[model samples]
Target: MRVHEMTITNDFQPQYLQLIAHRASTYRSDIRIRFEKDNILLDAKSILGMMILPFRPGTVITVQTKGTDEEEAIEEMCQLLENKTS
Candidate 1:
């Protein structure tokens, strides 16, 4: 398994956070997510699960992935979170 740390720079507000979370959820189905004051933990491949996390800007998030495609999953997730496209 692989784990990565990320920060949410955009959509720091509550409503935007919700939107981001929802969008992320739509991308994956069963992600595990944990909320923290400065960060979150996302279990790999759990898009839906990660979407429910209540996060704000500057929040730190840890993404963890397991399985044969763990690296790919982590990279994809990082891009999704960091990418400004939309």
Candidate 2:
């Protein structure tokens, strides 16, 4: 398992959805996205899951991955989340 923390500069924008889908498709079920805040654990890959999150600039997001390619997956996810675009 791998974990990293970063601040989100945008909410669930269209580009974000596309980026997430593209990234998620590259890996097997071993990879997953979770939006953690306090006791909340939401699926980051799901469009609806991301839409429902109370996202805003400066929101801290913790991405976690657990699998053989977790290291690469984590790096990709970090880039996607750090895009900070609309």
Candidate 3:
């Protein structure tokens, strides 16, 4: 298992969220995103779950993964949240 702190930067738009879920699903890891303040944990690969998270830009969230590709999963998720283009 691995965890990293990431700040939300994107606008959480529908298209971007679909992109996020697609990225998350490419990994073999069990990934989750959490809003520590509210104890809200969401499955990273679920578009519905990601959409329902109540967060905004600059909100610090925890990205967690447990599996063979945990490291890459976390890094990619962080980049997505940071709105970084690869």
Candidate 4:
């Protein structure tokens, strides 16, 4: 497994972050995501699980991936977090 810390940018506010998280969850199931502030952890690939997180702007998040394509998953997730486009 691999873990990384990422900061939420202005472009990825609460709504956008939620969308990204939801998307990430859909793309990969062997990943775990945690909200930085509250340390709430959930399966990133589950839409319902991602929605449980109350993410906001400036919120920090920890992403962990474990699987055959863990690195790719992490990279794609990071890109989604940083990219302006959905």
Overall lDDT per candidate, in order of appearance: 0.55, 0.69, 0.85, 0.71
lDDT of 3 by residue, 1-86 (tens): 99998777646777778788999999999999989788888999998887777657777799999999999999898888886432
For model 3, which pairs clash?
none
For candidate 4, which ten residues in a row score worst on lDDT? 8-17
Estimate the lDDT of model 2.
Answer: 0.69
**Candidate 1 vs 4: which has more lDDT:** 4
- When sorted by TM-score, best at the front, the candidate numbers are 3, 2, 4, 1
| Cand. 1 Cα-lDDT | 0.55
Best by lDDT: 3
RMSD of model 3, in Å?
Answer: 2.2
Off by over 4 Å in 3: 84-86
Off by over 4 Å in 4: 11-29
User: Candidate 1 on 36-83: residue-level lDDT in tens?
Assistant: 563555553343544456544677677665656566666766676677
Total residue pair clashes for candidate 1: 5
Ranking by lDDT: 3, 4, 2, 1
Q: What are the runs in model 2 whose C-alpha is more than 4 Å off? A: 29-38
TM-score of every candidate relative to the true structure: 0.58, 0.74, 0.87, 0.73
- Across residues 1-86, which tens digit of lDDT does each residue of candidate 4 receive? 88888876644345665666666655543778778788788777666665556544578888888887788888887777656552
Error of 2 at 14 (Å): 3.3
